[model samples]
Target: MSPAHSVLHAVFGYAQFRGPQEAIIEHVAAGGDALVLMPTGGGKSLCYQVPAIVRQRAGQGVAIVVSPLIALMHDQVGALHEAGVEAAFLNSTLDWQQTLDVERRLARGDITLLYAAPERVVTERFLGLLDDLHARGQLSLFAIDEAHCVSQWGHDFRPEYRQLTVLHQRYAGVPRIALTATADGLTRADIATGLQLQDARQFVSSFDRPNIRYRIEEKKQPLEQLLRFIEREHAGDAGVVYCQSRKRVEELAQGLQDAGVNALPYHAGLPADMRQQHQDRFLREDGVVMVATIAFGMGIDKPDVRFVAHVDMPKNIEGYYQETGRAGRDGLPADAWMVYGLQDVVNQRRMIEGGDAAEEFKAVLRGKLDALLALAEATDCRRVRLLRYFGEESKPCGNCDNCLNPPAVWDGTDAARKLLSTIYRIQQQDAGLTFGLGHLMDVVRGQETDKVRQFGHQQLSTFGLGAPYSEAQLRAVARQLLALGAIGVQRVTTEAGHAFDTLTLTAASRPVLRGEQAVLLREATAQARGKKTRRAGALPVAAADLGPDAQVRFINLKAWRAEVARAHNLPAYVIFHDATLAAIAQQHPQSIAELEGINGMGTKKLEAYGADVLRVVGL
Candidate 1:
């Protein structure tokens, strides 16, 4: 048998490889390089991990994995050890003595996978260790996880990753594999260019996470909306609540906690220990609700996370996808719910324009944000639009908010053109000076505010042309224009030393204004009729619908899992994932022989826990 398949069964406790994992492992194990673009929970780790173990078992050398997330490193190493794989990690969490011991193990060829943070790597001392290993012919491979971090255009770009180019330079002959969960075509190309992996065989997996149910709501009492979602759909389940600001994170966490939800806050503003503890508890315990900024959740691998709720809009689609991808890792039913308002759009625009990034980077960021806004305002199936962003096509998912309860949409083509024309008209009226959305909307809605009169925008022909719509309607129109990329916001400072936004028309706007493009906006009235088109008490759990016998079996298996987890001091899902338990309960595997045929049950796991699982199934 191939060593890779042997390890896959004996160690990971899996019967087979998913998708391209086996092929990628074979290629990389044969000393070839690969670039893998798989979605979250798509068994990416196996591609490198199986090869790492295979090469080590073959007496080649130890594999060095460069990771960006320290917390994730800890979790992965623990899981590997449970699988009887020799794995260790080097990061700040380890003391000097512990670090020394890990290095010793790696050098002695006792460790199959040695995980290190990118910053810990590329150091002189680490390089020296690698050099020693290379001299001893004990270096198996170099694996760069989260390879998108190397791309400066990526949302989670880490400068430390750019220096990873040193790996190729130093270990010229070593086979390397780089993997990431989310990256667009441009970001993918940039990842290849930055990591110098342009020649590596690119294995791009489908970006579809079919298990997650996507839903977006226009913000109306966002906290209450989030509460309704949590209480009505996912109460007592593991979930993540993403906010846009540290302050908002704290407030929402406290609010959720006060509302009887087991919520906690995590952000860069909190003490390091506090942040770490919060993350640990969220990982190790069930029923935890983590309210955090984008600072959290890069490589979190908790498989049973039931939902991910965004209290505010993420800056871009990449960020949104990465954040939402954290849910439903167990491939069970999960929800990706979000509530975004006009303020969220404006705030994101200000952040993009007022930030310190280069023009090229900002331009890329704008495209991503615009795409996200389009998704938010989409009248069709959200899944189709989201997949299209990643260059994939599919039929309506029929499970997303749009599919189940379609939002009312209005033709905003004329409103969009008016908004874009207002920007162009203001530019002409003020000798190329432009105003922000507020001023432009004020003039369009015919609100003779002080800024409008002072700027003489009231005199423009476009002024008062949009008087048919109310102020709120005008605001909605402006947001749709920005979302559609018809209008863009820019940073501007006036002579009086006041900082404000300047509106600009995009290339996408010209066609819309010339009566060549159609625009659809979610009707503003939908927010008022929220949750009315559908009848729902709670989001349906995937396994909740099992028949009475299977249901009882599932409960019994879950109870056994809990007892085992408590005794082992591990998370319940870690002992056996929900999906695995569901399979066992449904099939009623009454003996070790029958259980051995289960997908997630490995030889080691079956030998250790198979009897217990069978007993729970009434053997």
Candidate 2:
């Protein structure tokens, strides 16, 4: 057998490689550079890891892995140790003495894989160590994880990542591999250019995460809706709830806690220790629902997260895809749930226009935001649209909300024209004074509210033109117009110094107002009705489809595994994934020998836990 295949079985316990892993590994192991794009939970680590072991065994020496997060480095090194691999991480988590010990090991060629952050890898002291290793022919390879961070177009860009090109400049002979889970065409090009991997073999896998069910809802009583979703569908399940603001994260976390859900808040504003403690609980314990801002969940490796809910719209599809991809990493059924409204569009736009970025950068951001809006307002398959954003074509998934219960659409051309006309006439009559949605709706529907009367909008020619439409319907139309850039929002401060959003016409407004472009909108009431029929109840467990006796065995095995995990202070999956436990339970292995061929049961893990697994199965 080839060395890579041998290590795959004896060390990692996998019978075969999945997708493009084998090819990537063979190419890299033969001293070839590669850029790999694979989805999360697609066995990305193995592409670099197996080769690292193979080359190390050949006396080439230690592989240096550049990672971004300390938690990820710790978990990876711990898992490697469990697999009987000599791995160590150098990061701030280590004291001076501990750092010295790891450096000494590297010098002695005692470590097979050394993981460090980009900031540390670029330091002069670390370069000196690499120089010595290169002189001794001990630097085997360099694996850059989360490689998208090097591209400015990527969702999570780090300036430090740009400096990583030095790896290619200095170690011209050592093979290098850069990997990321999410990147569009632009981001991919930027990554290639920024890393100087223009000629490296590129491996792009399917971006589809089929296990996740995409569902987007129109926002109305968002917190209540989110609570009901959790209570009804995901009770006692580990999930993530993303918000756009720190205050909202805190509030939602407290609200979920008050409602008897085990929820915690995480954001960059919290004390470092507290953040780490919360992260530890989320990783080590079960049934934790983490409510966080965008600051959380970049390099987290928790594999059993069942749902990812967004209380506010993300600025772009890339961020949304990356955040939602965190769920269902174990390939079980999960949900990507979100609720957005007209204000979400306004808020996201205001952020883009209000930022300190250059005009060119802002334009790129606006284009990205527009793509996300299109996905949000899409009437067809959410999965198809999501994949298309990454330049991949796909048929209807038949699993997203649209395919399961297709939303009804309506010809909103006249309504959109009327809405735009109302804004125009009101602005012209009132000397360009702007109004928020409430007052705009009041004037459009001829409500004769106190504010409408005060503004004398009741006399406007366009007033009452949209009397046939409900407020929700008009809001949907307005949202579409804003998304289309036919309308823009202006932040106007009142005499009391309170700022509020007001609608204004844009260059794109002329076509709609002049009867040149037709507007199509999803029926708001139909969307609300469709939500009632969405799948509800607990997420499917690994052993859900097993026979009754096998199910019991699965439960017992899980109990045993949890105890062992606590003893080791590692995530339960680090010991054995749920799929492995289910397989053992289903097969009902009679002896340690019978457990030999089960996936994920490497030689070291089998030697350590094989008898215990058989005992649990017999129980």
Candidate 3:
């Protein structure tokens, strides 16, 4: 049998490889490099892990994994140890004694996987030690996690990642694999070039995350909306509530706790130990919610997270996708709820324009935001829109709000054109969203608002033409334009009442007809009405649905899993995935022999729990 398959069975207790895992492992085990792009939760780890174990068995050497997040390193090492793999990590969080102990283990060739962040990896001390290990044939492979960070244009760009090429040049014989969950075509190309993977095999999995249900809501009373969403959708489940501001994160966490939800706040502003403790609790305890800014939740791997809600719009869709991808890793139903508003668009724009990101990057970021706004304002299936964005063609999912209950959509095509023209004029004059709104009204109704007269916008022929619609209606039209990428928000404000907090339009705006454009502004409004449209209710299903039989089974399984998990402090799935339970239910295996027939259960699992599983099922 292949060494890779043998370890997959003995250690991971899986009877088979998932998707391209086996092929990728084979390639690396045979001394070839690879660049892998798999969706979040799509078993990216196995691509490197299985090969690392197999290569080690061949007496090659230890694998060094470069990870970006320290938290992820801890989690991965814990998981590997639970599976009987000797893994260690070096990071700032490690004490000198602990670091020295790990180095000793590495020198003795006892560790299979050693994780280090890119920044610490090329240090003078580390490089010298790594050279010593290489001389003794103790350096097997190099795996870079979150490879997208190497691309400056990527959302999570890190300067340290750019220097990772040092490992490739210095350790030319070590096969390498770079892994990430999200990246566009451009970012992927950049990573390949930066990492010097000119001859490496590239594995690009479908970017679609079918398990995540994408959702966006127009911002109203955001706090109240978030509260209602939590109460209705997640009665007894763990989740992450994200806010753009540290203050908002703290307030929301406090409010959630007051509302009877188990929640804690985490942000960069918190004392280091406080943040760490909160993170630990959230990781170890069930139903502990975390309220955090984008500062938290990069490489968290909690599988049963029931949902992710955004109190404010993220900077771009990449950030949104990566954050919401944290939910439902257990392959169960999970919600991605977000509340967006005009102010959110302005705030996001302010952040983007204020940053040092390049103009090209900013343009791309703006396009991504516009797409998100379109998803939020979509009157059709939310899932459809989201999948389409990732370059997938799918029918309505029939699960999201827009599918079960679509919103009223008004045409407002002419109104849309007029709004774009107003924004364009404002852009030409170097004004922002706040001023654009006033300028638009002046052109639509011939209204002589003082600013309009001073700006001489009232003289425009499009002026007074859209007077038929209310100011609110005009703003809605403008929003759709921005969402659709017809106009870009030029400036933004975050200090509580400046105009430009949300989205701005770019060059994608459709040109307006000066004489003919006025003709369309007066047309009938298109209504995107909600179908079933009742506000979301408390947990879609009652806890009582966990029937007596199911409850007993679930309890026994959870207890068994919990005991194993706590013994090693690794997440339960690292021991036996939940998918095994559903399979057990369907088969109701009556004996050790029967349990062995289950898809994921291997000889190791059979020998360990074969009798217990049979007895629990009343066989």
- In terms of lDDT, which candidate is strongest? 2
Candidate 3 ranges with C-alpha deviation above 4 Å = 379-388, 417-472, 484-488, 491-510, 513-547, 572-576, 581-619
**Tens-digit per-residue lDDT, 178-197, candidate 2:** 99999999899999999999
Give the distance in Å from residue 485's predicted Cα in candidate 2 to where it truly belongs: 1.2
Better candidate by TM-score, 1 or 3: 1
> For each candidate, what is the lDDT?
0.84, 0.91, 0.75
What are the root-mean-square deviations of the candidates from the true structure over C-alphas?
Answer: 3.3, 2.3, 4.9
Which pairs of residues clash in candidate 2, taking residues 3 or more apart in a chain or in different chains? Answer: none
Output the TM-score of candidate 1. 0.90
By TM-score, highest first, what's the ranking?
2, 1, 3
> Model 2's lDDT to the true fold?
0.91
Worst 10 residues of 1 by lDDT: 531-540
**lDDT by residue for model 3 (1-619), tens:** 7898888877776788878888899999898999998877788888888889998989988999998888899998987766678899999988999999999998889999999988899898889878998998878899999898998767788988989899889999889999988776678889999899868999987766666767666666777777777766576678999998999999999998899888999999999999999998888767788999988888888777878999988876667778888888766777788877666765665666777978988888777777777677777887777767766678888777667555655557777666666555655665443564545556676788788778787766577767787776676666565555565555556468664432345555534423333221212223223223223222212122455566566556656776877887766665666667656755667777677657657665676667777776672
User: Model 2 compared with the native: what TM-score?
Assistant: 0.96
